[model samples]
Target: MLYGAAYYHEYQPYERLEQDIDLMKEMNLTVVRLGESTWYSWEPEDGVFKLDWMDRVIDAMHAADIKVIFGTPTYAIPPWMAKKHPEVMAQHHSGTYVPYGYRQNMNHAHPAFRYYAERVIRKLISHYASHPAIIGYQIDNETSSGQLHNPDVFQKFLWYLKDKYKTVDNLNEVWGLTYWSHRINEWDELWKPDGNSTPGYDLDWRRFQSQLVTDLLDWEAQIVREYARPDQFITQCFVGAYSRPEANVFDISKSLDIVAINPYHVTQSGLELDPQNDTDTIGPEWMTSRQDHVGVSQIFLNGDWARGAKEQNFLITELNANSIGGSSTNYPGYEGQLRQAVYTFISKGANMVAYWHWHTLHYGFETYWGGVLGHSLEKGRIGREFEQIGAELIAHSDILTDLSTQADVGFLYHEDSKYALSYMPALSQPGTGNPDPLTYERVFDNFYRMYFNVNAQTAIVHPEQEFEKYPLLVVPALYAADDALLERLVAYAKNGGHLLLTFRSGYGDEFARARWAVAPGILRDAVGASYQEYSNLMKEVLVKGEGLDLPEGAAATAWADGLELESAEALATYQHPHFGQFPAIVTKVVGKGRVTYCGTLPNMPLGEALAAWTMNKAGIDPVIEGLPTTVRVTSTTATSGERLLFFTNWSWTPQTLPAIPGGGKDLLANVSISESDTLELGAWDVKIIVQAK
Candidate 1:
């Protein structure tokens, strides 16, 4: 388990490399990510390359026994490149070129921009590839920004569409361009996406934009691999669904070695484990935003998303350090809170945990984005907490590395659906007539938190992944899917896998076009139900009965589907004036398996009951039983044949639970405990127990 921060030796106001090294050693830091954010420091002038300065920092860190991870510095182009190649500046959807003074303002697909970025990536990797201190390379930081619409980029998109469709008529036919008199006579007659109202055209354009970003990172990976040694892996730090909905993490990560993510959440009351902590970001627009919640399921969702990137153990390239956000927002972790954050990441298969920075910045837009050491450049509470946690990580080293997390429930994360639903949202804000652009994530999170709050260890499964390993698969808002994918979902259910479907699923084709078949497109027969009409609610409407644990006060929120059962039975029904005539949930047995469709988004109580029903249908027990809501228990298996159970208390109040049913060694305390014993945990505590599988 490696621990440290993104050490920007060049960003310091003065010469304090020696002092930083002392502090890192004090915390038993094992890794340092260097040179990712500073493109100007790499090449100040157009043709000038000043690269030897990094050698001093890497050597010193190596002397202090810390591993190094180099970055390609392609995301932030130098100033000279911007001045020399202004054509590379990216244009937004409004037909306006983004001004300078901001990073990622250029088109990644532009030829001239690629030339300079390739040069720097080659220079950095080749110069430091031979050093034993280096263990990996990050091709880019965060990777994608808002979509690029440069003229050249659009021309490239035109070429892509032409190659895909072969003719303008084919393109028009596929995109349904006849609507609104949008039918094009010539390819050049097509309009920009700014004023376009066609869903199919907008969907294809968004997909092409994502392909450009994928090609950009894959190009960087190709260049870096030319110099990177076999021992050094390559990765891109992805800030998933939280930001940059345009960047397709699954396709981009295919060209790299492992998946890395930057999962940042709120501190203080945000981590309280309260059910009503309902604050959250507004989906892809959240670049610098943070979600406040009592249940820390978002981080787990982020981790599971990363794990699904390559379907393996992943790394935390960046995470929370202290009080994050602007100057006005200051809520750093309280006492043991920082330790809980670290362990939370580890519990979900983070091989390495690195903070955003080693020290706070003295001058920058993120000056208030605090770090391990604050602006005082002094040892503070964050440092004291990490010192102890860092030592504990070293003590539990062997089992922690390369541990694989397993879950019987697989939740599908479809980026195409997330993108398609964004343009054609199904839900709206509570009292507004406007659509909620984050409808997909809103629906996804509702189901994700439902299962998490019920203590079900759920795994994120992508569209291309094998689904047979999971006995139950919950698909939320599979709003966009092709015939092949929908057929596969039916086959999985027929083969004895419990399948749970949600609203907006199977409603559209791969092109985001509403299917001509009866609602739910191809999966209607398997689902045993279909809905032709749906409605959004301004407020909650009561829903009752059916689910085994359905409690009182359960209601349907947001959108509801008027589902009519064919060969299935009603599980739950809405208590609305008209919606009561239709079922809220329906289920049917197909072959050896069963299919359950949720026609409406359930509130917390109903969601938990539905989650429990899904578990019961799958015939699996909760990983942990009779534990406080504040305590999270999860299990991961090591490649060396051992089951490692992680117990985490998310609050300041201590907790006690029955020890897991086995005599196992507590990896954190280096003590042994037998079955039928009670386990004690302090405020904001974490424990890992290892036993024979």
Candidate 2:
């Protein structure tokens, strides 16, 4: 609802803060984030503190009437702590212990690590919890980018296994160590798993490691909760998904008040995958600029999906401040792209928006196009743009804060499945593994893309919940299934609820063991499909939409079941240029419920058709059109018992929309009307429209 930016105090000299604060106040900024890269600046010495300066900063923010969300300063351990307690060091993927060089360098699992971090957080939260200036507490900045290929994480895995299974005998049995010659008799004999002998080699262990990180995050959150006010929200910013280990990080982190994510949508220059490559030419198709935007949105969607399970609003904590890095060659998003990125979040129903930063590092503010506010006023064009959006948000605070919405579509974003898949090394490897890593990523991506294509209102729900809340449940290419989930979904379908599940959804147990009934498991009756060996479409399969004569291209392939149907049809078929027609997309009706299964991840347009088809079957309808791509609209009611709608335009471009037929006037520009023409949306725009009655 309000505009906010990550505030780094270490480098923000008094003069810079003055300029930034003045500019922010002029733009109607409501919140300011302090602490992130300021870890070292805050904790200069161990058992020593430096709030004399932070006090002044907080007082200044309060005087400006800006709400503050202070971040705990232990994200990056100070040099003093790292030097004194070497155990706090984070181990990277290649088995290298990284020194305290970058931010977020502390080992979350270390005992001494938690001790110091907890100490620092307790002091910081207690100081600011009651302060009139502080609105909330953000624990850390972008808690991602770990060298997961580490011995410390591996050792943590061993400890977790011992705690869960209670014995090495049990651990060995679950991992099939008897076949791999990787059996362990004594817990002490366990060394961190490598790419081969170690559980790190398995996808399940990777999942366990993700859980381990989540556990650490929980510990951090609990420590802060001990001192903070009960009403004040708590959140930790998470980076977009980069790997399987990071796939479910936010799902676990969603226990916080709001899930925060940083999205650096891609630009023409490309990404920083290789620290060495500095060429102008793009490297690979995956390494291109557009893919970067897709990847950013993908990660954001994953985080929001995880947050959906909490049934609470999520926030985009950090976005492109021109560039988040100090590189002179950083990718800069155009105002339009930034607008689109924000709109995507708004359309998806995010609660708040915050940019990466306020002031750029004059020393590190390299100008390939990254700094929001350069040292001088003349170069602060981006900052001015931010102010325009922020002022608009401030003008419409009530609708921004009080609005919430519910959707009819539920995506299968299971934390249990994501975690289990992460730790299974067999699944981490490609082909012939129980939770194949590539397969997991693709399966998740395909489902997300399809959901986004139609701006489908979605929530993340477990298979065990009452599906009556959701008219349609779309579970894509899942490789495992649990009996509890199977039974609940079965009941949901039979109860006249619409259930749209896909192939490979029900195949295995919680431990990645094959389920007894096979092929869509217990869902075979509801979907009219039974276990049959699936044939991967050799060539691209075409999914023909209703009326639109185009085929959507999807990746991971499979085909099963031609059920006896009262009302159903095969919408798509698999065909090689040489090999002929095999059914690809199939649908069937059971009870009052309908299930549609796609054998592959169809292209975006085709995926939209599938979603539209499901929507039609469920009787769901979209509210309005002609809104900016960045603006998301959700409806709720006020305490007065009036209908309220929240519209957030997450873009830099101006947008225009038609007035509501009756209710409240458009709150942003203060325009009053009874169904006027289009409403304008400036970049990073938000509007609240209430039912006037």
lDDT, each prediction: 0.84, 0.60
Local accuracy of candidate 1 as per-residue lDDT tens digits, 205-248: 88898898898888889988889899999999988444476788
Model 2 — which ten-residue stretch has the worst lDDT? 269-278
Q: How close is candidate 1 to the true structure, as a TM-score?
A: 0.97
| Highest-lDDT candidate | 1
Candidate 2: tens digits of C-alpha lDDT, residues 249-349:
44555558776666555543232222243235332233343331353336346445535645556777776757544443455554544544543455345
Evaluated at residue 263, the lDDT of candidate 1 is 83
Query: Per-prediction RMSD in angstroms?
Result: 2.1, 5.8
Candidates' TM-scores? 0.97, 0.81
